[model samples]
Structures are given as C-alpha cells and as structure tokens.
Target: MRREDDHPKEHCAIFGIFGNRRAAWYTFLGLYAQQHRGEESAGIASSNGKEIRHHKSMGLVSEVFDESSLDALKGHLAIGHCRYSTTGSSLAKNAQPIIVDYSRGTVAIGHNGNITNAEILRAQLEAHGAIFQTTTDSEIVIHLMAKPTYNNRIEGLKGALKRLEGAYSLVLMWEDELVGVRDPYGFRPLSIGKIRNAYVLASETCAFDLIGAKFVREVAPGEIVIINKNGLKSIKPFPEPKRKAYCIFEHVYFARPDSLVFGENVHNVRKRLGKQLAIEHPVEADIVIPIPDSGNSAAIGYSSESGIPQERGMIRNHYVGRTFIQPHQFIRDLAVKIKLNSVGDALKGKRIVVVDDSIVRGTTSKMRMRSIRESGAKEIHLRVSGPPHKHPCFYGIDFPSKDELIASKRSVEEIRKFLGVDSIGYLSLEGLLGAVSFDKKNYCTACYSGDYPVRFDENVSKFATER
Candidate 1:
C-alpha cells in the first residue's frame, strides 16, 4: 500500500563526490544529511575508473548501506540517491543510482525531479523497440543516452537532456567523470561544493555541511558541470528559458531549514514568509504555537511580528515510523495520534494562534485542531505561511489530485468550518512572492495559481506512466 501524508512529498535527493578516496563514505554522509528529502529508498553507485558497482534497496540510507557495503563499492567517484517515488512505485526494483552498461562505457544516474513528458517519450522509444528494465521515468534518460546517433558521451547526454521537459537535477557518473545537470527552467535545487581537493554535488547544501565541504555555488540553470581529475568544467547546451521557475515550496516546506535553496537561506526565507503572513493576517490571542518541526521558524516569525509569546504547544515524536500498517481507520488515527501530543499546560484555557506551513488535504490539520480543542484552548486561529494549495504539483512534489485538496473546491469559510477552527488565514500569493528575496517572477506558484511554467499534456494524469 502507498504511504499517505497531508504534506507534499519531495521526490528524491542526489549526492555525488569526486577526487576523494572515501567517495562512497562521503556520499553516504551527504545523503544522510538530506534524508529529509526522501525516505522510501536509498542507493549509491561508484566507479573505480574501469568498472561501476552499485547497491540499492527499499529502505532508509542507514538501512540500505553500512561500512561493509560502502567498502565493497570501491571507487574515487560515487553518486547516491534517496527517493520517495514521484515517478515510480515504492519497490526495490525502482530504487535508484541506476547503473547502465551501454555503447559509451558504463554510466550511473541519480535523478532528483520529475519528467513531465516521460510517457510521451517512452511511447516513442518503445515504438523503436527499446526495452526497459524498470518502470521509472529516469530510465528513459539512460535509453536516450544509448542512442547510436550521438557521437560522444557528452553529446549524447546533452541531446537526451534537451528532449526532456519539466524538472530534473541529475548526478551522473561515467567512468572517472562526475557530472551534474539542471533543467533549463531550474525547477529544482542543486549545489556544488568542495572539500580538500574533491568536488561534491547534492540536492541541497546541507549535504555539503555534513561532509565538511565548502559551499562553492549552485549548478546554474541549463548548465552541465563536469568534474574529473582535470578539474571542473561547465557547459550550457540548451537555450535558456525566458524566466526561471525555482520551486518556492523549498522555502515554504520541502527543504531543510539549515540548507541554502535557490540562492537563499531556507530558514531565513521561511521567517520572512511568517513575518509577511503575520502582516497579512493578525489576530489577538493569548499564546502563539507552531505545528512543530516544519512550523517552528514561521511560528517564531509570527510570534515576533505579532508581539505574542510563543510556546511549544505540541510535542512531536521524532521516532515515529513513516507509515503504519493498520487494518482499521481507528487504528490509523491512533498512529497519527502518537506522532503528536498537545501540551495541556500551554494550550489549556488560552486563546491560542497556531502557525503551520500549509494545509494540503486538511485531514491532519483537522485532527491537530481537534487535539488542541480537547486540550482546553478557548479559541484557536490557524495561520498558514503560504497560500492554500488548490492544484496538484506535477513537477516533483507528490501532491494529491485537485479533488483531494481541501482548498480546491471549498471556500475559506467552508474549510475553516471543516477543520473546526475559529478562523483560518492563508498568506496571499502576492505576500508569498513578496517574502522571497529573488525576482518574484522566477518562482513557480503552479500549486497555488494553476500557472504551470513548463507546458505539459493537460489531458494526461500526472501518474499516467507510473507503475
């Protein structure tokens, strides 16, 4: 069965290290740091200049690899992946850092985003008798790279990348070369770092910090960065888009608060959003409380801006399993109940304001509100840092269908009533953009505005090609 959550799920995390004797070890650490990005499965592939070896399974990073497994993958060039499966089902066969032996030696790929045109491209390739081993959109790239028309590996890679549409931040290793590529529109985050003489690539900078790597810069949009013994070289083969579409949700919720995403510190950006949200919607309350982990920074900003004392009203169980195998709805509710517990002392008899990042399905939010009410809160006002998520996200976030979104059809008043909250306030789209430090036009708000930056076949369901 599929694991379900109220929040949007990130697709994957990719990490690579070159010019290091302990490349696999460093890659392991990097993926461990960004484990928040994906938790369904983890994998790592390494090249010892002549051969490529890999290990992957349907589990967390720590569960998938240990010292013995890392030691077996002997190489100075390695790439790793942790996935939550936006394009494929959560099965062992779909685990990544997919290795392929082809016309141009062996290459391993670890991808971070979704390919919107995968189904169309897959059909075209299938017509030509191309065989696929896995039901993942990422395999399409390897097949394209194996085409006979391209003369060299780099040319083949560029040709394949140009044909792809939607989000992709890839880490590819071919023999001794370690490469990273970002889509022209830059819908996902990828960064470059250096430790000693080694070059590192990862989905977020937090990975670099874990491996003691110095932050170099971000992989530019439409750029391919190649790192080998000779040093790092960059090439841009595709035409640039008119405007960049960096995922704004990275700051609002997806990314680790300690990481730098799209050239801005995530925690700082979230604080700004909270401050802006407070400016947009202010309420008189006795105490301000956050929804825990994701809501911590924003709640701080809200408390600071509103001049209300902030308290930890809810305690999160960090050790809770990602999913529960329950036979009944009540059992599932018990699983959710164990994940968070309301503090009666802080919330009891107090008019409280709860700050959260976003409300997706509203089921979890409703449960949380019920918990607060049971804790004796006199009044509860819910404030969201970002605008209501009304549409599905086709680019890497595992957002539910439009009908599944509570805000898709219901009005604010109806949603407030459904959640059993005194009032609900979501930051306006303008306010969300205002909080971002970069050009507002560069960020994608498709989940809120239904304005997709990269065009896709509207008729097809986002999961049409997934197995």
Candidate 2:
C-alpha cells in the first residue's frame, strides 16, 4: 500500500452539454481529452428535460463506461467528470458527477479545484440542520442551494459561490439546464464550445476536437453560462473588474499540448518556453533527454539552443499504474526503479543532460538520477523546465508544505546534494513568461514566488485542518 503521506492527487476534468440527444456520448469524448486532469475515477450525469440520471465509478473514462453504461445515460443535456481525490478518502462516494435529490429538483454537479473554506461552510451548514451524505466539498453546493433564504435556487448558488475563497470551476446540471462557472481568478480552465446545434462546456479546448465541436471562447473569470431549451445565459458573479490569475502551471505541465487555453496554444507555448530555458541556462552536453510526457517540450528547446541532439534516453512505461506494489521498503524502491528505465545504449559513456517539468519533493528526481547512473552514464546534468516551487499550492496541486519543499530553504548546491546530481539548473522566472504567449501581468505564479494574487490570512493553514 502507498504511504499515507502520499496524499491522493485531486483534480478533475469537467464537461457539460445542453440541447442535444448526443450530449452523453459527446461528454464521454470530452472527458477522454481531459483524462490527464484526473485519473482516479470518472462519471457522467444526463438530463432529459424532466429527470436526471447518472453513472459513476472508480476508473479512467474507458474503464468506467462500457457500451451499455453510456447508452443507458441518454439525454438532451449532460455533464461529466474524471476525479482525483483531495479532501476525502479515495472511495466511490468522492467520485463525480455527484447527483443529489431535493424538493426543488435533481442537481448533478462536477467541480474542478479545491474549496479552501469547505470545512467552515460544512460546519455552518450542519449547525443549521443540513444533513450531508458525502465528505466531498462538492456536496457543499447542494447545501448552499437548499437554503430557503434565497429567492430561487440559482441565486442561492450564486450567494454560496461568492462566499467561497479558493479555486473552482463548476458545472451544475439543474433539470434540463447545464450551467458552467469559473472562479473570479480563473485558477482553473473552463471553455464554451459548439457542436452543430448544441453547446458544450469543458475544461479545455482540446475536448472540443474530441467531440467534433467548434472551439468557442473561454468562460470568463467570474462568469457563468446557463444552457437549456431557452438558450445560453451568461452571469458574472464577481463585483468590479479584477485581474485574472490563471494558473501558469496549466501551460507548463498540466494541460495537453494539443489544447488551446486563454486564446493561447499550449504546444506552441511549451516550445517557446524550451527555447527561453536554453537562452537562460546554456549547457554543453552530449544529448538532452526529457523526463517523458511533461518534460518533452522543454527538452526539445534545450536541445535546439545547446546545439545538442534530442534523444529519447529515458523511456517511461506507460502501462505502470499510479500506485505500485510495495509490500516492503526495498520493493517500494524497486517500484520507482521499474517505472522509468534508461535507454542503455544511448547513455553509455555519454555526458547526459536531463530535463523535467518540476521536482516536488526531490525523491523522484534522486531515484531517477540513480537509475541513469546505473545505466553507465558518465555524467548527468539535471535541468528543470520550471521555476523551483518554494511554497505550497493552495489551489489544487498536491505539493508538500514549505519544510518539505527543497527550494523553500535550500540553495542550488544544497539541492544538488539532496538529489545527488553533478550539475543542476532551473528555468528562470522570465523563462516562465517566455513559455507563454499571454501577458505576464495576468497569470498566477504564487506557488513559485510566494506572491499570492489573492491575499489570505496566515491562518489559512487552518483551512486544511477544517477539511
């Protein structure tokens, strides 16, 4: 079993469709494109203008939905999600889209990112006689909507949503209507698309391609889109104009290169970032090898700038499950060993430079370094494609506390000692902006620089205790 300290990664891709019989199928395709956002579980809910039904399970999209299950959820409107647990344990109850029944209507909701204030809200709700059925913060929405003080359910949701203080992109299904909302800072991505006569709401533009939908605009920060037979209505929940703090990591490591976010192409941005990294940290090496998947783009840039050939020296076993069989400590170390192996012939006697997206705790990097050394590499130079994470991520990422962050209190030389590498380099702060086409003034880099766009009291640590 994995250690308890290895907190389950929590993130999800949310999709919604309205005014289409093929919505359930289309949402399935959307979830496929966004599968990288989460991997622990997946689910879908559909509405036929009268009743809402759903199917959710613990697995990837394909494993969760077979031919029969997909067919069973036919509706003119639908919303889907792929889950990664954060707040609650990794049980079936934590899966999305979470469907609940109330006197007003049946609401199925899918959300991305964490709500920092969930525990306080939960306690307040319970004190007022609200009975909760799930430990998920997502369920808090049901209680918020069930309040009788509001004129209607939508207004009640808006009130509850306004009181929230952290990152979230919500997709709510109310009877026949499918609604999508983005937090004021747009810490998460959500977009609107069109598939012939239908409207689609998804976490990324790549989902549009999967469902044969034409890419439309993103859901503006603090904006909400309501879709039903009457058509789409937009709502802006935040007051005044606030600068957006879109997560910069979304372009750096999280999103698929094929996707378009905030009118910027992900693949192109990554290539540019690679070029910038090379300009900032020039290095001489026999070959530059990416750490696979996330590291590919930055590696290519490092290769082009250093005039070194880009070689696939390290190969990842795509079949490896997130959790490995580690019956003992030695076996656990071996589990990390088999996850990635070096291309022996490519690395023999060669001075290698390794590039990866980021190093969370340095354990994985140390293990990978050892793997390369075992393959008979003469020299190993490590290059990180992103800035050092000096602070914990309060939004959604599973980063460790400040004490656990190597960069938080250590210098480059110290980090090299911790990871056992000959030479180490990281992309510069400017290199971060060089990776994206958008203006630096708008993006969020709080995790890297400790300059949070939204100021919260230091007591914010108490939020975790509440959850």
Candidate 3:
C-alpha cells in the first residue's frame, strides 16, 4: 500500500540566482534549505550566457547532485526545483527545471504551483496538433510560450500567464536572463534576495539565509521580474484582483519556522496562532508537548500562555523517508510508529496536552493518540493550531477530497470520540486570521470556510493532466 503523511503534501520549491559564478552551488544550498517544501525529486539548470545545461533526478538534493555534477553545470545564471508531484505521477521524466530548445532559444523553468485550467488548455492546444512530452501541467507553459498565438503578443511569458487560472510562482532561465513570476491571485509565495551584486529569487526567504544572501522583497502578486546584465526590471502583466488570496496554511504548517513569507515571519505568526488557540480552548494540563518539527513553535506558545511546562513527549525519527512499503497486513500503524515514538517517562501519569499543526484524515492522529494513551497519560487534550480543514484545496496543496476529510462530516464531539481524546479544539477561522498582520480579507480560508478566490470546475480532478 502507498503510505502517505497525515498532513497535506507540500508544493514544489523553486530557486534561481543571477550574476553569480557559483550559481549552481548556491541553488543547491537553497534547495536544501527548502527541502521541507518538496522531497520527491530535485534538479538544477544553468545558463552560461550561451548554452543551457541541466541535471535532474528522482531523489533528494544531496542525492541528485555532487561536486562533479555541479561543476559540469557551469554558468552564471541558474534555476533549481525540488518537487512533490502535485499534478503528475512521480516519475523521473517529470523532474524539473525542465529545459527546452525552441524557436526563441533555450529556456528552462522551475514551477512551484498548479495550473487549474491545464486540462482545458491542453485539449485546445492538442486540437491544433501540438505535441507534449511530459504529463506535468508545468510543460503546458513551455508549449504556450512557443505557440505563435502567444509569442506574437507583446511578450510570450505575459501572454501565457494571462491565460492561466490558478497558483504559480515560477523561476525561469531564458538565455542569459533570470525571470521570476507570481500569479495575479498570489496563491503561493515567492521572494527576491540579494548577495553582493548577484540577484536571487526563491520560494521562501529561508533559501536566501542559507547561501548568505539578504532578503530583498516579495515579488508582488501580479509582478514579473527579469534580471540580466543591465539590471533588474519589473513588469505588471496582469490586472490586480479585487483581493489577494495568499495561502494561510504556509504560516500554520508549510513554511520553515525561520523563513519569512508574504511579508511576515512564519515563526512569529505560528506562535501567535498557538497563543490564539490557547485563548479559545484553554485546558488544564501539567505539560504541553508538540507533534515535533512543525508543531514545535506552536507548542512553545501554548505552554507559555497556559503556564504549562513544555516537554518532548514524542520524538520524531528525521531519517525516515516520506513513503515506505507495508511489508505485511498484520503490521498496522507501523508508518506512524516508525516516524514517532512516545517518551514513556514523560507521559506516564501526567496530564498531557498535545499540540499539532492540523489534523487531516485523522488516521495518523488516531494512532498517535493511541500511542500516548498506551504510555499511561492520565488525560490527553488535543489542540490544533488552525481551523478544521473541511474542503479540498486546488491551489497546489495536495489535500484529499472533501469526503476524505475527517471534519467535513463529523462534529467536533464526534471527532474527539473517534480519536479517543478527552477533548479536541481547533482554532477558529477569525482567530486564525487575527494572528497574521495582513488584512483579514487578503487571506484565503477556503479549506476552512469554502470561500475560494478563484473559480474552477468542481468535477475536475487535481491530477487531470496526469496520463
């Protein structure tokens, strides 16, 4: 059986550097820092102002490229991608920084979000005799750019972007220029950074931190930035929407705690969310323990607000890969057990409060609760940092369908009973928005409130482009 994480799968991470001799190395480091965003595969493409060369494989950044591989991709401008297969099957052919040589010139692209309208567009293009190599929606961009219909416009990139209907934060290497683009709705995060004279663009500011680069600013919702020998140039190709739909889940779970996304620090925002959760659902407990890694910041805030001591009740095995095979049917819950083991000494005979980012399908959460109960904990109060995820997400996040969500049909009390916890509390939608600095209307709470900013066909599967 295919083993999946309890949480929503993360989107891809994109990185690019211009005017740096060690561009490929820096890109590799950037990808390494943002590996949490994607872990299935990694690739890097570089341009030497003349020819474009690339190396990609179905593995981690450290596994895919070595010193010799980096040396072989010699260039002053480079772009990289680490992927999680949001739209296509996990295969070597789908690994990206997908390079192509067309009529305009050699161009490579690293994309971080999904295209909701790819199925419709692909059908139209195929009707006119267009050929495609990969099943990924990312490849549609290249075909659109190469088509005479879009290329004949003022600019091929802008024209192609105008036709797209969902989230996309792109890093493109077109000949000698490095390009970055964010969709008009701003459903994903992309930022600009600088190191010495070189310009950098990445999915998160944390990538800049790893390579000794300084955070510059975020690429605006509808903006496209081009970096070449002359300087950096900006263009607003699409009209601004009535409101921006920045994904709030980035703060709750996706981004690294040290990274800055959407003009706010992720760690601070998550702490605030935890504080809010404590305010809404205060529980009397002797100790607060996080789910680990993603839940650490929130647990700290919970402990601070409630005056409960914080402890590591459960330890995670970081070396465990994303997926593993189930050797036998009798070995149930082995995936969860392998990833986390309860600290019996810390949990035995203690009133424990467990904090986690969110509960998706509840399979892993149920198993975790059973493990805690087996450790002799007197009481187990489960706290979630965000509101219940009741709807499917179409803007890159790999959430299951609505029916698969535990909260979609069950009431809070029912869910608590199912998980076998003493009580369960999730942060309210209003409380979640209050934790962020931006206006409440600027955020997308579709997964909680079913208020999608962009409209899409309900019947279309998220993996419609997959063959």
Best by TM-score: 1
For model 3, the local distance difference test gives 0.90
What are the TM-scores, per candidate, against the unseen true structure? 0.98, 0.94, 0.98
RMSD of 1: 1.2
Give candidates' CA RMSD values in order. Answer: 1.2, 2.2, 1.4
**Cα deviation in Å at residue 407, candidate 1?**
0.6
**For candidate 2, what is the TM-score?**
0.94
lDDT of 1 at 66: 86
Residue-level lDDT tens digits of model 2 in 1-467: 56322321438899999978977888899998898888889999998888988999888898899889889987889999998765345788778998888767889999897787777787888898888766777888778877778887789789888878778999999887889999998889999999888999999999998778998899989998888787889988788445888888888888888898877888777777777777877776899899887889888878887888999988878777645556777777776656678898999989998988888778778888888988988998898878888988777776677888878988988999888788988888787976676678788898789977765555656234323
lDDT of 3 by residue, 225-256 (tens): 99999989999978779999999999999999
Ten consecutive residues with minimal summed lDDT in candidate 2? 1-10
**Model 1: per-residue lDDT, tens digit, 1-467?**
43435788998999999999889999999999999999899999998898988999988898889899999989899999999975448778889988888988999998988899999999999999998888888999999988889999999999899899999999999988999999998999999999999999999999998889999999999999999999999999988789999998998999999999999998998888888888999999999999988999999999999999999999998876565477777777765567888999999999999999999999999999999999999999999999999999989889988999999989999999999999899999999999888899999999999999988988887766676
Q: What's the CA error at residue 120 for candidate 2, in Å? A: 2.0
Give candidate 1 misplaced runs (Cα > 4 Å). Answer: 1-4, 86-88
Extract clashing residue pairs from model 3. Answer: none
In model 2, the runs with Cα more than 4 Å from the true position are: 3-10, 457-467
